[model samples]
Target: MRPVGLALIALAALIPLFWFAPLAASRDPVALFSQYLGTAALIVMGINQFLATRVPGLELVFGPLDRIYVLHKWLGIIAMVGLGLHDIIDADMDGLRGGPLADAAEDIGEVSLYGLLILVLASVITFIPYHLWKWSHRLIGVFFFMGAFHYFFIEKPFANADPLGLYVSAFCILGLVSYVWMSVLRPLAPRGHAYKVASVRHINGLTEVLLEPRGRGLKHVAGQFAFLSVMGGGLTEEHPFTLSAAPRDDRSLRFTIKDLGDYTSRLYRELKVGMEATVSGPYGNFSMPSGRDPQVWIAAGVGITPFLAFAQTLKHRESGPIKLYYCVRERGDIPYVADLQHLAEETGKLELMIVNSLEGVRLTPERIVEDLKGDLRNAHVFFCGPAPLRKTLKNSLVLKGLRASRFHFEEFQMRTGIGLGRLAVWLWDRGIYAIEKRRAEKTQPAE
Candidate 1:
């Protein structure tokens, strides 16, 4: 189906629960609707998170389904708002005051208050932009677990009162269990080995940290990433950093991270040698296929880090037939240029092309296409950069009659949750559904 068709279908499925107005006004509609919507939102969030980490083919769905993902995030915010509204505007507030909710709130007292506080904290933290979200998102997970416990014990009375609420509660419990299992419990399972940072090297305005895994070493392929978290620090903050070192190096693993923002900028200043860090994986499919065909790697700025891993892998194997086009704003912006140059010198099969767009030397798609006219037909192009640059290159490749399968890329941004509360607020603010009306022309029916 088309992207719009899929979105319309999803909207159709979700809208009816809200649009049905009053389903027996004697019942508390707000509470009832909020329970359903919030549960569904959590389920969807869990599914999306799981798919994002585990599924490779999700890119096909997510690529065209960006609008659905946006809607999902807004819907999550809306669900949170809906829950808040349900609490505030509950018709049974008087009954609840003297009953289960109130008694639970009073008996547990400070623990209940802390759980509510944590929920509020999680809501506030999620509102930040994607980049900052990475550093702060782990705390949100803490809030999630706290909230789950609160819901399990304190709020069980309300959920048990109604059949619909019972079902919602059950589903929510399962969803929370699944989320925690996939994200936290599974990753922390004993692997019987550990890695320590041997040396942290600062190169080309980026930090390249070498990791030495004790015992059986980490088995990884080129162009994959590992989720690394420093010991003593909470597991919630484990960030995925691409491996810049060759996979063949069993003795150690190296990660080159640019000082882009929060986590990275502090790596050199705060992280120390001999610090034991846990590495979770070597995930991603941005490497060249095994067959013997020419390959081109297009990298912009810090995107060169992954290519370093690929180059290192090729170097260790003494394999060639791969060309790299490294583009940057200036000559100084290029990371590991000398190393890449040395690799090119050592391996005659490797070709290096550096394009400086800022030095009045514009690197247009047309120019790149012309440069690789012969090789472009067979080579699979792997590009990593900012969205706009990727789009330009993608469009250029499409115009040149290149297949979509020939291109590969990765996004560094995190997908934030969308709730129904945010959607309502957005619609209210923007009047998004205001469709243009066309005047009906007078028509005569044929006899």
Candidate 2:
């Protein structure tokens, strides 16, 4: 899908360039022609922005889509440079440089110098990987408006001067309108629900926060997460955090976070009581089984957060026969240990196994399989942790002849960074393919 989107945008940009090639016999004509191409490029950018936000299920291609996003930024810079050259050749620089202060300002406004400046600034700010960049990028919303204003008000004159220009100008306006609708208005509309923090506690070198919906709502299932936006900060900057509390009728949500990066660290240090948060979620399908089938949840370090939710849900719902193999560096690294213990005591169907790597206690898949040699036959296994740990556990389980369908894992690393638009598009394409394949397989007659 990303390749298709990129190809479409590239075609839009190139079409104007190709149309102008025949007019290169006249320098003035060529300069004017390039301005039209620049306008087309802006329209392409608007289309890219629109598709990125509206599309869903993009995580699968996030790794490659990030490269496309870098290309998108550079393409914008190239368009701005081309427009600058076009203005230099077509418009009178002498007039722009020598006019009165008010005249110069008016000329500047006519050419979208302010819009270009804002675009450049927004692009630079986005390069910063910190949470500040997350907050600052909301200002890019202003750039879309500015670009539309520049297109409709300033370029419209050139557009009206010629039939070809008018056609391009009308299309640009339409694209800009679509971009604004999708990127700004739609996101701000009430779509998802909200949650309030029930409690904030420090455990196992992580901050555990419990949240519940502000009103009547369905509880989240185990292994699902919510996208949380802390108010007082910009609303556009939301991060996904796994739920650490079980699903229940009580209106409490929980998140266990370690101080790893800028956002989580600040969430631990700076979040206060009564801080309003918007939650868009309960996404993911990693849940324990409910029948007589045995299940195992393997977690490492703060990755135990989701497992805690599963355990709690199991305890409260009496959905049982579950085992947890939680590995941590030290006793202090075990998040919600006391809570897990309490839940285990309440639900005799739950077994808690703790492995401390820092205390010279190493756990290999072979050793784990050996410990539960007979128990491995009828169990589903779920794992959430660092890549290396997950890989080891997965290999161990596979060696024990566990079917692939019985293994569940959550990959949250793909959700990091600023290029969600590209990610969303990529995910949408993959999700469509997966759905189609599933439907085909389901409908096929058995051999």
Candidate 3:
């Protein structure tokens, strides 16, 4: 997917250079560079919007949800660099540089550029509050429209009767159309049914939220997740959590959320029974395989959420031989093991292994290879853990003769806000987390 994504970006980047090279070379140096900058910026923005659509066809090529987001982040960074260069090189404020026609349009373009810089920055800044970041994220379309207007109206080569103009404008139009459909039309889009909290179970700093649909419910498979919004919780931001149980006819949903940050830590106290919420989605393709291939499943910490869904799913299927290694800091950190044990008994094809790192029984790639032994020959490795751990195993086990395609992993962490930016933003985010955590502590609901 990375190579494929790079190839697509290269195509978008090259269209303008190839199409307008003759004209640009014949123009002023400043003008040439400015046109290059503007074209590159808009092209990459178009690529970003295409990825945002989440079309199943495109996702099939993208492979994983996180990979698409990673591409989105890189495209945003590249577009920002282009916009910055355009602004720096084309800094004539008055109508003196461009014609009287472009003077006002150029200013509008500058305003859009500045707004975009802030929106891209907020995604990585983290401490700005998720809701604020998301709301600002929606402003991308407004600035994108402004940029498109600037491109079309500024009397540049793109405005002329060049294929370059039509080509770039096509992408801009497609991107804006996708944006309107996704961002503007999503709220009005009929997806899944509305849900309300039926119960909340507190367990070892994790909250098991059980929701029942108000009308019809979501049809979700095991190992898939949905975007959850708990209304009346003082925070209306939607967060993704895996469905902890298999699909049942009653349309019930379960999400075991670990208290990882300020937002999650506050969920238990703020959310009440019967609180209205929305569950819109059953996204992800990280379920069991169709073939009769032997499988190796790995789970770490809270990453086991998806695998729990898989386990419940296994109950109804003709289960195959499975080896699952659940790694945790300690035994107490492992949630829902009893359920897994019962699943093992019921399925008779599932084997559970617990690895407690604090007890010095660390889970390593070599250990996995040794344990699987002959089974490792053709077994498909499915990992639902931290990215670093998965990458490490991929490198180590691939050296030990693991097939790259057979090894699959899903990133449970949200990558929407991750991007290339100042290292200080991370520190600032941590500080914001500390302050918010303290505030959450101080404002704990009275028992």
Q: Rank the candidates by lDDT, best first.
A: 3, 2, 1
Error of 3 at 110 (Å): 3.2
Candidate maximizing TM-score: 3
Candidate 3 clash figure, as a count: 0
Q: Residue by residue across 1-447, what tens digits does model 1's lDDT show?
A: 136544643553355355334443544665555444444444443343343343345434544233334443444454455444534443232223243454454344334334434543453454555455444544434544444443444432254446544544554555466567656786667632378878988877788888888767677777777677776433235677788867764757888888866667667577788888777655665666776666778888888878887876665564437768888876554678889988888867678888787776656777666667655677678887776788888888877866777887765433533354576698876653443221222243446
**Model 2 lDDT tens row, 1-447:** 246556666676666655555544543654456456456656655654543452345323332333344545555566566556655556321211221344443354444655665555555543456556544444554555555554444422233446555555665565566666755676768755666666778765588776667776545777777677777633335677787777766756777778777777778776766677777665655666667777777888878888887776664564536778888877444557788889888888778888888678776767656666667767788888876677777777787777766777776453233455567799999999999999999999999
**lDDT tens string, model 3, 1-447?**
557767777877887777666764556657676778888899889878878877657756665666677678768988999999887786332222455657678778889899889888887676677657777888998899898888877856445457888888887897798899888786677655689999988877779999998998899888888888887867466777888888878999999888887678789678778898888677777788876677889998888888888888776786568889998886554688999999989988789999888888978888888877756668788898877788898888888878888898876666544544456688899999999999999999989
Which is the better candidate, 1 or 2, if ranked by lDDT?
2
Q: Local distance difference test, per candidate?
A: 0.60, 0.63, 0.80
Choose 1 or 3, whichever is better by lDDT.
3
Measured on C-alpha atoms, candidate 1 has an lDDT of 0.60
* 2 against 3, candidate with superior TM-score: 3
> Any residue pairs clashing in model 3, and if so which?
none
Q: Model 2: what TM-score? A: 0.57
